[model samples]
Structures are given as C-alpha cells and as structure tokens.
Target: MTIPKRMWWQNSSVYQIYPASFKDSNGDGVGDIPGIISELDYIQSIGVDVIWICPMYDSPQVDMGYDVRDYEDVYRPYGTVQDMEVLIEQTHARGMKIILDLVVNHTSDQHKWFLESRSSKNNPKRDWYIWRPARYVDGQRKPPNNWIGNFGGSCWEWDEHTQEYYLHLFCPEQPDLNWENSATRQAIYDSAMEFWLQRGVDGFRVDTVNMYSKGDMVDAPITDPKSEWQFAGFQYCNGPRMHEFLSEMNQVLQKYDAMTVGECPHTPDMAKVLKYVSRKEKQLNMVFQFDVVDIGQGPYKFQTTPFNWGLPQFKHAIETTQNLIRGNDGWTTVFLENHDQSRSVSRFTSDAPQHRVAGGKLLSLMMSALSGTMFIYQGQELGMVNFPMEWSMDEYKDVDSSNYYKMVADRSHNDPKEMHVAKTSLQHLARDHARVPMSWSDAPNAGFSAAKPWMRALDDAAICNAKQQQSDKSSVLSFWKRMLQLRKQYSDLFVFGEFDLLDKSNLEVFTFTKTWQNKKALVVLNFTAEEQKLVYPTEVRSQKSELLVSTLDTPASDKLAAYEGRIFMLES
Candidate 1:
C-alpha cells in the first residue's frame, strides 16, 4: 500500500477560538484581538500548531460576527486592523500559524454591495444578490418560494425599496451573494482572501462553502406536512457548480500556498465530500463534515425532543468518516465541539461532577488517536459543560435559540406546556451553551471581564477555570496537553497509520487500533457510567505492551472504570 505523503496540516493540531467569549482586554464585556494576544503563550503551551479565530469583521452583530459589513476592516469592539496585524506577526513569531474565518457566502445587508443592490431595480450592483419577484397566490403576494431560513421563518425577505424579495439562508440582515456573477467572485477573492494573504495571514476556514452555487429556486419538497415552509438544503447545499467555484477559488489560495478547510453542512455523501478535498480536484485541503455532530438532532436542530442514539451509532459515524480517506488523497477534520454545536462532554458522556474529568480525557484520547487533523475548541481542555438547566430563556443569547423558541410558541398558540418543552430542549441543544464566557480564573466574571460578561459564565467556573487546572497535574487540561504531545511524538503511528476497528459489536466500549508498518497501538475506551470488562483481542493478549497514557490513576487489569481510556504500544 502506498502511504499518502505527509503535509504540514495533516500532522498539525488546531485550536479554535470564538473571539467574543474568549477574553476581554478593554473590559467592554467582549473579547478582542489584544485579548487573544495576551493568551498566546497559554495556547502555545497546549501544543497546538495553528489557531483558528472566528469572524471579527465589521458587522452589525445580527448573527454574531457572521454578517460581514466590511471585509477589509475589523469590528470596532474587536480592536483595529493594526491590532490584527500585530496578532498575525506575534503568532508567526511563536511558530504558530493563524487562520481567519472566511464568511463570503453572504454579506450583511448594510454592506456596500448589498446596499447598492437594494438601491434600485436598474442598479449596476442589483445582480450581485439573489433577488426574485414575489409570487401572487390567491390574490395575496407571497415569497418567491416556500423555503425556510436556517434560523426560522421565510427564506425570502421582502424589500420595500426594490419591490422584490431577496434570499437569505440565515437571517434577513444577511443576504446570500450571487456566485453566478464573475465580478462578485473576483471581488471576494481580491477583497476577502488576497487582502489578508498580503498581510501575512495564513489562510481561512471558509463558512458554508458548498452553499455558494445554488440550484434552481423551485420550492423544496415538503418533508414535514404540518409546516408551511420546507428546508431547501437540497436546492443550495453542495449545489451543482460547487466544485467549479471551489476550483476557481483554489487558484487564488495556491498562489500564496495557503491552507483551507471548508465548512460543508448537510452533506452526507462522502463521495461528494472527496471532490472538495481530493488532491485531484484541486479545491480545498480538508472539509468539516457534520455527520458525527448531527447524530441526535432531528430534521431541525432545535427539536422538542432529541432523537435516540447511543455509542454504537456515534462510533459508526466516526469510523465511516475516518475510513473515507483511507486509500485516497482526500483528507478530513476531526472535531466534536465548535461554535455551532453544544459541548461534547455533556452530549456524548456523563457530565456529572464525578465523571466530567474522565469523560473529557476519553474524548481527547479518542480524537488524538484518529487519522486526520484534530481541532480543539476553547474551554474544551478544561472539560467545560453545558449551562445549568435552571437558566431561563432570557439567559440564552443566541439568535437561533431565541428564534426557535418564538417559533415553538407561535405554533403552539402560546401554550405554557409547549413553551416549557421547548426550553428543556434548548437547555440541552442550544448553540448558546458553547458561547458562554471562558473560565480564565475564579475571579469575578470568571476573569473574562471586569464588567458583566455579554453572556453568563459557566456556573462551575470555580472548579473548571484554566488557572485552577494549570496547577493540577491530574486535571483535564493537563491530560489534553499530554495527549497532544503523544500525538506529536508518535506522528507516524497516529497521524499516518491506517486505522482498524475492533469488536464492532460492542455497545459500551469503543476499541480501535492504529498500525504503521511494524508498529501497532491499541486504544480502549469505556463510554458508560459503570465499570465494564476489558476484553482484549486474542492476537495482542500475549504481546508485550507499554502503557502510554490512561485516564485512570492505575492501569486496569480486567475491568475498566467509568469513562476510562487507555492507550498501549504493542511490540509486534
């Protein structure tokens, strides 16, 4: 078998930071570039090679910072462009690369291009956005189609000035750009991409990349009969011309030798994903697929009740994704937590006070042993969990969470029982759970800010803060550092080795092996709350093994403790 050539990204691990909740330098209750600069040494200590910062562009904060009003400038609260320059320089000086969030799939309605497009029907920039006349049904004007926005409500927003409706996959304030227009594509390349490359910025984490080339604007098939609108992901996600546009964009990235990881949602077909990352396609270096994270979700993320799922299903998702690039040149990303998803510990394992540390270490061991680039989100190293269930709806600040709650209330005609059910689901699944302020120390506001934070800090910050963990050798944060270091030390065995699944029928334990030539490593993980028997494969039972790391205080002989994970090096 011909092993794929190793690249810098393949062997590197990434640390993702959501700037708003990371730290606050100016005490405005918001994290800024200078705040990130102060923690550079701390991030380096975790042994990450790249830092991926979420969008901080000038915006109205309609969808956090996803709505970009100015591609060339930084948000005033996030410091100036010069501060960004200093961040880039400092990160590189420390031998770590920095990648910015690229959100060109849409622009804020307040952006110059969108403003010009909405000025008049005959404006030159009118073709820059997707606009269509309203459909009159039964003597009443309606949106162009029966499509639902990702957040909620109609996807088409009526514009009073142009007398036409424009499409917004997310919110009305953020309008989708017309990728069919060559001029629009060129402008994004020059302004959003090349501008940063010229400033020594590494690359980007492209947002909703596959949604750039949309199909025909026909009404989506009604999957939920009770709903008025339907999800139009089939019409826009992984559209027909996605590769063509991505290949064109790759031409620009190639000039600077920059790396890219596209965010492709609603994509279940691994073959289609390969086209985006395969070296033969010349598109992107890797892509973030949503299969593993979407396990318990229903048709929509904010369901009244979560779908039933277990470790077996979760393992299948991971194995399927990992095997996608086994013999191919394509690559994938391994991540359990991000800005859009809830905390992995609370969702995947028992998050009780007794099991939280072991649960966090289990996840680190599993992900670090997998094949591909691993990404660690902020606060994950400290085993941060979801917000307390007692938090009221007013405490949840994400736009999606609030919109979903309102939709449920409207549909149920203000039923108090229905409202309570929605709140329960939001407590478990809302994106706001991940947006809580990082616990820096036990100080007021968790040391996130001198003033009140934009969002509440975790209730357990006193125990989960970084300052407390950094001093404790047995803390979850310390385990993460050791696991990352092990991955680097055994790069050939962990990063370039072929993965093989073992005991696929086991429901409580996740067992796998990574083999590179004569070197073999066995990984065992217990996913339940109770102790389980450790049944090793017969072939390796007699072989001498060296213990690399274990979540438990002592290595298990016959039974594994709750959430225990162990990695052993076997002599072939």
Candidate 2:
C-alpha cells in the first residue's frame, strides 16, 4: 500500500484514546501508556490510521490534563516521556500517525510560569498571565469582569499572594495563559509544539484553539444578555490576534510537516474554515466545528430551553459545512463524538432501540461520506449508549457536568424531583460517558484493566463487548469495519466528493448525495422511531444502487425499521 503524499489525513481514520481510561497495564486502577501499547493490535485491527491521545502532561488533575504543570514530561501515572516515545514508535510501526493533545490555551496555576507571575506584582515574568486588581465600577467593588467560568464561578481568581485577580476561563486551578504577550506565546510554542514535533508526534488536537488569543477589550457589556453569565463564550474564543498566534505556531510546526486540527466552536465560518487549511496557510489543517454538535438544544446543559432541532437541523448543519469547505477545495475534520459530547446513536435515535444501529450508521454516512478527515472517538464505532440510571454521582468526572447539577437544580426551579433524570441527562452529555473504557472483553471490568476502571463499566458488557462483536457476524463493530474498508476501497467517494443537499422538508430523516467525477453515492438516514416514507427527489434515482452498508433489513421487504441507515452507489 503506497501512501499518497497529498492524502496524509484524507486517507486517515483517527481514533482518539483518552489515556486515563483506555487501558491499565499496572494494577494501579488507572490507564497508562503501557496499557495503550498493549492494545495496539486491537487499535490497528480496527484500521485506525491516526491515534490522537489526550493530554497526559504532569498535572494536579484540576481539569484533568488540560491544566499542565509540566509541558515536557508525562505524568508518573500515565508513564514517562520515554513511554510516549515508545507509543509513537509502535504507532508508526503499525503505519499509524499520532497526534498529541495540545493544551496550550491554559496551564496549571501551579506551573512555574504562574508561580513566578504571582510571586509579586512587579516580578520579572509578572505579565505572563492575565492579572488585574479587584475590579471597581462607579466606586463599587467587583471582580475583573462579569464573565462566568465555564466550570461555574467567576472567571477571575483573586491571587492573595499578589493581591490581583487572575483570569481562568475554565476551572480556577487552570489559569488562562496570557497569549497577548509575544514572549509568552513564543515560549509556549517552543515547549509544546517544538519539543513534540522533534520527538515525533505527527500533529496535535489543539485544546480550545479558538479560546487562545482572546479579546483584548476588558469588561465589555454582555453581548448575550440571556446567557446566565451575561457574556458570550466569544469573549475568550477566536478573538483578536488569534490568527497571528496561529501563524506563529504554523511557522514552527510546518518545519516538521506536523499537522494540527483545532477544536474550534462555530468555526466553519463561510470562508473562515478554509483560511487555516489554505495551501498558503498560517496554521492548522482542519478544525472540529461545533454547530452540528450543539444543534438540538439551545444549551445542551439546560433541558428547559430545548429547541427541538432534529435531524433536519443537524443535516442542514452538516450540509452547510460541506458546502463551505468544498468551495475552497479546503480540508475539514468530521467527528460525531469526542471527550466532550453526547453519543450520536443516542442523539439521533430517539424512539427505536432496534433502529439505533441504523441511526448511528446513518449519521456516519451523512458525515464521513462528505469530503473531510474523519475521526471516530472510542466506542463510537460500537454504537455505545450513555450510562443510564445505574451511574452514581461518584462515578462521574467532569467539571461542566458537576456544575450543571449544582447551579441549575440546586439553586433554580428546574425541577428537583427529576434530579436523577436531570443527572442522567447531564451524565449522558458528560465526557465521562464516552470516557468509559471500550468493551474489549466481557471480563468483570470489560477487560479495560485488571484494576477497577475510572468510570463505571457499562453493565451489559456481555452483549455489547468487543470480543463478542468481533466474533459475531452481525454487530456495530462489523458494520464499522466494513464501512472503513469501503472508504479505503472508494477513495474518491471518501475524499474529494462534492456534496449536494436533498429534501430539506424531511425532518425525520437525513439525506444527501456525494458525487465525484462520474461516481455517485446516496446516503439516506432515518433518525426517528416512526415508520416514515421518504419520497425520493428526481435527481437522486438510485433505488437499487447496491447497498454498501445498512443497519436494518432492506426497506423493500418492509417499512424501513427504526434506525435504518444505508449507503448506496447510485444507479445510472
């Protein structure tokens, strides 16, 4: 298999491995890099071309590894930097690329940079992070701004040592880095990008990439007044100087042909998405746009303001992304699940338990069939559902979720009787749900580790375990394997195809067409439980185009069962 020079990521299928829960080699009850090495065969067997490992940086675990205490060394629990080197060697040996999580937007408050910055107001490196006196307005005492932290409190933390408030968009312990300072940005670039590229990482999934280079203006009036915090997330995401900082990063990473994909929110901005991926680019190859993921509800955290945006809305979002990126012949990275998201199978399959598989495949077709780099977060291939009521509060580990439970229900009129229901919904949306270990074996702990797993293992592991699915003729895993192989089989369909939207009227189903040169693929997916009929548009006349993949029996035999999805080659 000769690898195409131009198709480095276009030919790749990235599998994200959250190190803390992937697998545990030692009996210490936490997953480590050695555990990841032990599972290479399983990952390679699934046809993964890229392994995007989450941050394993030495940290206080305040916000997991998002808060880095040491940018150059691995946490002792996960393993040493030498262990990461071994993982990289093994991955490349298996013909796979590795993307290290880039969490440069912020650092642990305990980091030496912050330690010096807080040592004194006039410390030599005092300007390395956002610092301000306790804010005052009209002679009234106040915090620096009205911005609320993503994890639930004031975004500013008062540093008693320095008598100043420091900015922290996330948790207080994870202070936002002052990217405005040239030296600070350059130094961070040298440590995170320069060191890793030299050590042999293929790329990075920049954490909160848009959140770096935040707005320079301070204490602006709340743009989104309805937001509980009153300020929009834009205050810290993709603000002024963002491109400048990215360009600086691009200069360094490009020296090693290292790729980057930013987890950008609302980022496929018409022509904006192409800017980074331009053949004459500044930084990054692609970004994970969030509009599609946040489609259904106004705020996924709040159930009261449910907007009821369904497949129609989600389909439209995907189509818009395809059209926007295709216009520039640019790149895009598509994802259905990640460390922070509700599973697609559950999101799209509302009523039918049986149709969930079809629903999952349907989402896959609509997204993957479009021209872009594709990423399948762990367990997404298995159509994994969210943890149900069995989940106790202690099993969860997400600041966003813990906050959602406290501030919303504990203080407001969101219905306390449905505390468990609310908790379950929030739990489903929590990163920990997807963070559950992949069901490799049906052993007592799903064989993720000999020790007790981080999050509770899914209870029905016997039926959904990977060992059973691998041996069984019919399984979500089988469907995914076939789909991946087919993507490799029809390279153009998976890469350079042009996407055309069809029948926006069908709210219950998602439909689209992919055509490259003369080849065509029609993808239709049913998202609901009802036995609905889809009247095909005249342009898409491919009833017998040979179903390449399906989640249910052919509709010709009966009404398309709930959750039925199919990808087909259009008949000329």
Candidate 3:
C-alpha cells in the first residue's frame, strides 16, 4: 500500500457541534447559528481545524433536526439561509472549515416530496419513497413484513390516504426515501450537496449512509419473535448497491475539493467497509464504525443486559480497527464521544474526581496519535461526564430514549426491579446523555443560554464548564489545546505512521507504537485509577528517547499515575 499525499482534511481535527444544545443567542431557549457565531473564538482557541455542525435544516425537529423537511433551508429556530451564509463566511475567515450534517436516508413526512408521493398511488412522485401494500393475516390487516425501526415499533406506518404502508427505519414521521429511483438520487445530490457546496461549505457528515440501498422487500430474520424490534438491520444496511451510491456521491465531492465521512452502522466486514473508503474507489475520505462503541452491547445494540467491562476487550476492538486500515488505502475516523453516544470520560475511564482529568487526556492522546482524522465532540475537551442518574424520565428529551423506555415498560410490565435496570441502562447509554446543552460557564443554564435551556446541563456543570477549565492550567481543556498543538507539529508522523499494538497481554494498560521513516513514537495509557510501572520492550530501552508529553505534570521514574498517559519520541 502506498501513502497518499496529505490533504487539508487529513491533517485537521474536527469538532462536532450539536446545534440545539451548543449555544442559544435569542433567549428563546434554543441554540441558533448566531449563537454558534458567538462561540467562534472559543472553537478556534481549542485549535480544531474543522467544525461539523449537526443538521439545522427546516423541520419539526422530531428527531432533533435529523428529519429533514427542506434540505436547502435552515430551521427557523436555528436561523435562516442568510445566517448560514454568514456562518460559512466567518468560519472560513477564521482559517477553519465548516461542514453540515447530511441526513438523507429519510425525509420528514412534511417534506414536499413526501407529500406528493403520498398524495395518491397514481401520483407521478409515488415512487419517490418506499411504500408497500398491507397483507391480510388471519382476517386482520398487518404490515407488509416484520421489519422494525431504530426508534421502536414496526418500520411500516399505514397511510390512510394511500391505503399503503410506508417504511421508516427511524421515527414514523421520517419516511425512508427510495434510492433505487434515479430521479430521487439526483434530487438528493441537487438539494443536499450541490446547494451546500456552492454556498462554500466544506463537506458533509453523511448520516446512515450505508442504508441508502436497501434490499428486496421481505420479512427479515427474527431472533426473538415476541420482541417488537425485529432483526431487520440487514434489510436496510450495507445493501448490494451501497458502494455504487457512495461512489456517485464522491463524484460531487471531488468536483468541489470537499470531504465526507459516512456513518456506517452494523457493518462488520472490513473488506466491504474498505470498499466505500478506498482511495481507488473514491467513495469517501473515511468511515465511522462502531466496533469500539459496541463494547458493552448485548446481542442487540440497545439491549439492557450488556456485557460487563473488560479492558482487554476494548483494546482488542480498537486494535482491530487500527490494523484493518493501517497499510491499506482505506481510512478510519477515530472518535470516542459524539452526539449519539455516552461521554468518553465516564464510559471508558474511571470518572472519579481525582482521575477524570487524567483519563480525559489519556483518551484524547490515544485518538490523536492514531493514523486518521480525529473528531472531538463539543464539551469533550472539558472532560464532560454522563448526566446524573438521579434525573427522572421526564427530564430526558431524546425521542429514541423515550420510545425505548415505553417499549421496555410494555414488555416488562409491573416488574419494578426490571424497570429500574432498564432505566439505568438508558441513563448510561442514551443519546441524550451527550445532547444536553454545553457547559460554557458556571452561571445558570451553564451559560449556554440566558433563558431556560431546552435540555438542562449536567449537574456538575459548575465544575466542568469551559470557562472554569479554561482558567485552570491543569484542566482537561488546557491539556486538549496542548495535544492539538503537538498533533499539528507532528502531522506527518501521526497521520502517516504504521501502528502496532504492544503488550496485548497487559489488560490494565494500553500501549502502541507508531513508526514512520527512522523515527518511532510510543504511547502508553493506564485504564485504571491505580498507578502502574511501564514495562518497555528491549528495543525501546536501547533507543535515544525524549519525553514528549504526559498526563502528569511530572512523572516518577518508570511509573505512571492513576489514569495517566504519556508519549515518547525515539531517535534511531
């Protein structure tokens, strides 16, 4: 495999902004584009090269902007098209790029296209969406197949007007589009890409990209016949024409020198995934796989009875992804926290007050040193943790979490013990944990808004807010700034080096080496809250080594502090 010449995107770090929870400027309790503009300096201060704002398109926000109604316009609460134009201009002036979330797997039921498609079976736009007739079973009408949605309930929703059921892999309001139709695909390009690309935006974070090409309509396999969520993932994921669609999308990106990173869920085949991102294929710059995120998942991703923690298991998953694309032309997008996952500090490390900062630094360093682009979620630099378990169900606002809670309640009715466990699972793994308004200051609403916030900040925002961390030299935010500087200084070494996981038998510690040309860099990380000594290989001992960076202010010889990480540069 040959190393390709570095591009601007390859060398830059990404900061993901969940628009609604980032900052609110109108005192209307919702974040807007101007709110983001207010924080431009704060984002630039952290040294990130790109800002990926989540969908702010026109919609009812049934899925918090993922359900797009107008792909070419901004949501009213988030500002207008003029505001977005200024945002793009201001972002470029600051020497940083901005990308918008492209959620095209489905369209809101309110969309003009959907409205036309569902108007009548004989409508010219009838084939724009996946609509099927209901089947009769035992003298009762039922859905066409046993497919289930990601947000709960059957994937098929009956439309009284058309007398047919429409497929929705997510919320029923978000109907799946028929990518099999060439006209529909062209509309996606025209609205989602060409319009935004012409406005001077950077690229896109393709939502559910692999689901664009679904297979023949059929009843999916079932593991638990009684459960409401059927195993229909294969029916709409990584389908036969997935690569073809992505390759076509790449043509649009290449014309504008833009980049794209696709969200590829439930796709375990590395060879198949590589096909979508290989340089030769020209499909995408990289892909985000959930191997590491699925560490604690049960048979199904959202099942309550997930496996308990074992550091070695996590290490194996990360190393597997690293090795998969190390020497190949395929690239991986490395991240631990995002809009839909739990915070990394609480999920992957000991979140005790004493170790939180160290653990945050360790994880940031590990991801930064890997051979791919790094994505930093908003507030992650401040070492944010999950919301307090004390929050009740009413306090949570995510649609997916609410739907799952009702499903669990119906299945395990009147069983208080089972209900409690399921609630705890939601508390730890729900998408809303990362969706709370960012903690910008210690003031009310954590300074995210002057008015009441749509979602309350975590209880510990007083201590974890960015204002507090920015003032303290030893805070996680400060360490993140330093880490970004180091990455910029060693761009080629970190982005082009070959990775090798070392001491795999050592469960408590994670270690790896990145070698490029005649130089080698070793990264050491301790997963526990207890100090440990490094056991260097014989080759490392003989090299001329220089201390590069460490989580601790000062290290005791050969010893690592609780949850500490360190990097060493060796000259051969």
Candidate 4:
C-alpha cells in the first residue's frame, strides 16, 4: 500500500480567536493585539499550529469588525498596523502560522470605495457596489425587491444622496461589493489578500466567500404569509459566479502557498461544497459546513423559535457529513463551536454542573478523532459554557441577538409572555452565547481585562476559568492538552485515516471507526447522562484491542459513564 502525502494544514490544527473577547491590555476593557502577543505562549501550549484571528482591520465595528473600512490598516481598538506586523512576526517566531479574517464580500459603508461609489450616480466607482432604483407601488416607494437581510429588514437601503438603493445582505452598514466588475475583483486581491501575504500573514479565513456573486435581482418567494420580506439566501448564496471568483482569488493564494478556508453558509448541497474544496478545484482548502450547528435552527431569521434537537438527529448530520468527503482530494473543517455558535458542551451535550467536565471531554475526543482540520475557538479548551437563562436581554450585546429581540417584540406588540418566550429561546440560540469574554482566571472580569470587560464573563468563570483548570490534573484544560497531544502522536490515524460511522440509529451513543493502511481505531461516545453498555459489531467482538484514551478515570470496561468517551486501537 502507498501512503498519501498530506499538506501542512491537513496535518495541523487551527485555533480561532475573536480578538475583542480574547484578552484585554491597557485596561481598555477590549482585547487588543498587544494582549494577544502576550498570550502567544499560552496558545502555543495548546498544540495548535495556526491562529485564525477574526477581522481586526479598520472598521466601524457595526458587525464587530466584519465591516471592513480599510483592509490595510488595523482597527484602532485593536492597535496599530505595527502591532499586527509584530503579531505576524511573533507567531512565525514560534513556528506557528497566523491567518486573518478576509471580509471582501462587503466593506464598511465608511470605506473610501463605498464613499466614492455612493457619492454620485456618475462617479467612476459607482459600479463598485450593487445599486438599484426604488420600486413605486400605489404611489408608495418600496425597496428594489422584497428580499430580507441577514440582520433583518429589507436588503435594499435607500441612499438619499444617490437617490438609489444599495444592497446589503447583512447590516446596512456593510454594503455588498459588486463582484461582477473586473476592477472590484482585482482591487480585493491587491489591497486585501496579497498585501497581507507580503506582510508575513500565512493565509485567510474568508468571510461569506460564497456570497460574492449574487443571482438575478428579484423578489424572493414569500415563505411566510405573515411577512412581506422573505429570506434571500436562495438568490444570493452560492450564486452563478461563485466558483469563477473563488478560482480567481485562489490564483493569488497559490502564489504564496497560503491556506484558505471559506465560510459558506446556506449551501447544504455536498456536491456544491465539494467544488469549493476539492483538490481538483483548487479554490479553497476547506469550507465550514453548518449542518451540525444548524441542527435545531428554525426556518425563520435568527432561529427565534423554540430549539429542539436530539442525539440521533445530531449523529445523522455528522454521519452524512463525514461520508460525503470520503475521497482523498475532498476535505472539510471539523468544528462544533465558533464565534458565531453557542458552546458545544451546552448545546450538543449536558452542561449541568455534574456533567460539564465529562461533556467537554467527550466533545474534545469527538472533534479530535474526526477526519479533518480541527478548529478550537478560544475558551473552548476550558469547557466554557453559555450564560445563564436568567440573563436579561440587556446583557446580550451581539447585534444579531438584539435585532431578533426587537423583531419579536415588534411582532408581538411587546406582550410580556411573547417577550419572555423570545428571551428563553435566545438563551439557547443567540450568538452572544459564544461572544462572552474568555475566562482566563477567577479574578474579576475573568482575568480577561483589568477594567470592566466590554461584555460580561460567564457566570461560572470562577469554576470554569483556565487558571483554575490549569493546575488541576483532572481539569478540562488538562484533558484538552492531553487529547491534542494524543492526536499529534497518532497523526497518521487521526489525520489521514478513513472515517466510518457505526450504529447510525443509536440515539444515546455516537460510535465510529477510523482506518488507515493496516491500522484501525474505534471511538465510542455516550451522549446521555445515564451510563450505557455499547454493543460491538460481530466482526470486532473477537479482535484484540488496547484502550488508548477515555474520559473517565476508571479502567476500560463494557459500560460507559455519563457523557463518557473512549478510544481503542484494534489489531489489524
């Protein structure tokens, strides 16, 4: 048998840092590049090879830095461009690569390009953005189309100066850039991507990569009769020119041998996803698929409806995803929690006080054993969980969460019962759950800042903080350290192995096997609070197997403890 060669990214792990909540220096209550530089050693200790920092470019921070005002300059709150250059230098000095968030699909309304584009109808840069005339119905002016934005309201925002409406798929402050123009595409490559690569940046985590090409400007079908605006993903996501533009961007990435992972939402088709990441396509190394995190999301915007999901459904989502990218060339990203998602321990498994540790360990084992590049969001290693349900709407600072709350309040006319229900659902599904400050220690502000943090820390930071867990041998932090070490020790099996999910119908357990050459390993996870005995396959019952790792301290046994996970190496 011939062994296949793997790239640096395929064999490595990525750590995502939402800079604003990571760590704060200068007592500013906001995390900055200098603070990130101070914590490089700590991040290196987790055995991650790449650091994917969210956008720190000049921005109005309307979407927490996703709205880029200047691709070349660092955000004022994050520090200066020199600080970013030092970050790239320090990261490379440690033998680790750093990637920045690329948000070229749109730019902040305050960006010079946008300012010029919206300045006048005959401006040379007018074609840089998507602009259309307003539609007048019954002597009343409405938006160009009935498409709804991701942040709520009509996608078209009227510009008084130009007397035309501009399309913003997200917040109105983030005006979508028109990719149909050759000048726009070239400008993004020169000013956004190559400029960073020249500054020693390794790669990028492209934001909304698939939304670059918008389909025909038309009204979306009204899925809900109650509302006039409709979801526009079908018309805007994964559109006609997506692959063409990605391939063009890939040409720039290829020059520096840079790694690229794209954020592709609303693209549920595996075939379409394969085109974005397949080795033959050469557009992106991998793309984030949201099927798993989106398991319980409702059809409406922001998932305001009640959250309902189970282990079986979750397993099915994973199984389907794992099987689709089975070929040597096709690859995917393995992640449970991110800046846009709630904590995995709280969402996928039990976050009850007694089971939180075990739940965290189980998820760690699952993600480590999966067949892809694993991404660990900051604070995830400490088993950090979501804020308590008692938190009021005022405590939530995420724009999406706030927008959803106001939408629900307006529709229900501020009925106390309706508002209460919305709050309860947001408790489980809001993006703010993941945006809380990282818990570094039990100190005030969770050791994230000397001053009051921009947002509150998790209530249990006293127990879940990294400093508290660092000294304890049995802590989630220690387990994560050990688990990542184990993955590196068996990279051939975990990184290059073939994945096969076993017992697909089982609700309380998730079982799978990874095989590479003559080696085979089995991973069993009990997803419930109660202990359960696993039934092995007939072919494996007689095979000699050695226990490799387990969430529980007890010796290997037939029964699994609550939320327990175990891995074993079976003889080939």
Best by lDDT: 1
- List the candidates' TM-scores in order: 0.98, 0.93, 0.97, 0.98
Candidate 1 weakest ten by summed lDDT: 302-311
lDDT of 2 by residue, 36-120 (tens): 9998888888776899999998998877788999989998999999999999999999989999999988899889999999999
Off by over 4 Å in 3: 305-307, 538-541
RMSD of 3: 1.5
Runs off by more than 4 Å, candidate 4: 1-4, 301-307
In the range 84-172, model 1's lDDT, one tens digit per residue, is 99999999999999999999989999999999999999999999999999999999999999999999888899999889999999999
Runs of candidate 1 exceeding 4 Å displacement = 1-4, 304-307, 538-544
Alpha-carbon shift of residue 185 in model 3 (angstroms): 0.9
* Residue pair clashes in candidate 3: none
Compose the digit string of candidate 3's lDDT tens values, residues 1-572.
45577678888899999989999999998999999998999999999999999999999899999999999999999999999999999999999999989999999999999999999999988999999998998989899988878877889999998899999999999999999999999999999899999999999999998999888868888877787458787778988888888888888889999989999888888888888888888998888888998788766555755337688888888886776676678787778989999888878886778778888998988888887788999989999988877899888898888887787788889489877887788877888889999999889998988998888877788888999888899999999999899988887677667788878778789888888887789988888888898767665767777889988898877888888888999888
Question: Which residue ranges in model 2 land beyond 4 Å of their true spot?
Answer: 1-5, 138-140, 220-228, 266-268, 303-307, 350-353, 413-415, 418-421, 542-544, 553-559
C-alpha lDDT of residue 47 in model 3: 97
Candidate 4: residue 546 Cα off by (Å) = 1.5
